[model samples]
Target: MSTDGSAESRPAIDSPERIELVHVGRTLQSLQHLRVVAASLIVLYHTELQITRLTDGIHQHSLGFGAAGTDLFFAIGGFVLVYTSHNRKDTLGAFLYRRFARIAPLYWLFTFLMLGILLVAPSYLLTTKGDFWHFLLSLVFIPYPHPVLGIDRPFLFPGWVLNHFAFFYLLFGSLLFLTSGKRVFAVSAVLCALVVLKALFRDQSHLLNFYGATVALDFVLGMIVAWIFLARNETPWIIAAVFLVGVSIFATGVLQNVSEGAERALFWGLADAALLFVCVSIEKQWGWPECRLLSKLGDASYSVFVSHLFALALVASILRGLRLFPTLGVPGARIVFLGAAWALGMVVYAAIERPLMRCIDRQRRPRMARMIVAKGP
Candidate 1:
């Protein structure tokens, strides 16, 4: 099976090779749906946290598994980039350009939208205070102390993930540029060193601390998974699932007590990797059918994740105006609010984000076409 993107680059295939290709393709398709699940976990986590704050921790749950969504995303991000970039020959400049075009436009639009909201209705937004410089830094994916929250964050709280993402891209992209797609171990080594530095320098300032977090190590774990897949080609679904369950139990501290930080990262990273392994393994072994809703949700995950907070805010505002929460009670209100936020996220994805991304893609097509023509056959 070809792990890399280019099928044409593969050597001549026999019957066994053809069968393996079909299996690998199916596995990749199943993994696509996992994005929606990850995004939903984040949305749920934020919803629970915000509601707990609103209700004075009356319903706060200690588990906070939703926060683990970020870990899952880091793991998935590492895997996908390594998987997709496996055999591509695009220049680092071109690769970064494509990534920026895909990520930045929508993020800028949302950042400014949040800024405008803060200007107009500060009381409604959670992180209300802002500085012009901080806002500008946020637009460029820089880690800055969020004016209101006083944490290393941006006006758009969820956008903090982008900082880690941009750093990973710069690191990986530079390695690709320097080595021309070789020296992968150097990349892994650098990531390991960063994690170790994060552990050792826990007293650093907020911004530096955020940058050095062990969570970034999950990306390396993901790359390892991709390397394993490429090397071995397949694993049994049952074995993968069993391994995942064991990891989950251990992560939950059933066998030993565990807390946050590197401990949590080690457990969650392994658990998320096991999850990816099982999802891909199942589809490869059984040829799982397409799931339209999950696939659509996956396609819209970024939009959903970025905008769900506003959706939840709107729901809260509406409920407050109607005074329905007292009747619904805390748990009931939470359930309703989560559903409303999820629905609004889908709306944002369909109505706003999809069109905006299409416009961006269209604008890039001409430049890309010219570049392709310039490099002529």
Candidate 2:
């Protein structure tokens, strides 16, 4: 669930302007493709679950492992944050604002949409229910016990990952005051300290538990990957072999039903980091030709992540209403649901997300230009 600006241009890694590159211009096509892959994994996982429910467990699949895609996304988020911000002269406010502008508006829109459905069509929602405090906390990316489930989920359940992302953004943004080199080390130390504290004290508080989760370590893994990416290139074949090994380990863990916590972070998180490292390394080493379709899907991966629940629910409802499941069967229904979810996500991206981003960029660029000119290069 990431977005990059401009897909057509490719920048040389050692270009003289690299240090001054505050905004990400040249898109990393490999990352874009990975975004699509991660989002699709999640969608497929949910699709399998939906099929099972529709079939009353008569037909079931093990794509529940696809939930590990969240780990992949976290790693990607960490990598992108560092890759874009490192060596730049971005102020804390500026860095946070950019992150907020990119993430919040669409998230808020989807949150409200979910809220409205919970209010007017409560039955339409599978697991979420409307609660004022919970909804409010969700909008601000706070972790609170869900009213219905009593778990630390936002009103839009998938937004749980966003809460972690918001935390990461704050931590990363604060570190922007330091030199880029020191920033990574500082943030990594802070995250490590938090994890250590959690292990030592075993705090049961929702906030502490959420922040202290070992999954947070995935971001550190990604930061390391970014540092490596910026520092030196690895052998492409070795990276590819690492990628294959990562996939094998990740798949094996998923098949074995690895429980969440340290195990998940170690298995899925490490695999995702390796996967991301490979993709970016390959792209940097030997550029990939643009595939517009995958690129577009990658661009909309964030939209897909946020809006997919709605799409899946809509598809499920329509299928149930039409009595299509029995005719289509579990496999067929899974395909329809997955396809519909991705299609709706792409539609949301094109119709809403893209325009919203452009509007934000339009308002932001002139002020940014003034600031740049004022700096007097």
Residues 173-211, model 1: lDDT tens digits: 777644322545667788788777777877676665887
Reference-based lDDT, residue 363, model 1:
62
Instruction: Name the lDDT of candidate 2.
Output: 0.79
Query: How well is each residue in 103-129 modelled by candidate 2, as lDDT tens digits?
Result: 789899998888787789888776777
Structure candidate 2, residue pairs in collision? none
TM-scores of all predicted structures: 0.86, 0.90
Superposed Cα RMSD, model 1: 5.6
Most lDDT-accurate candidate: 2
Worst 10 residues of 1 by lDDT: 12-21
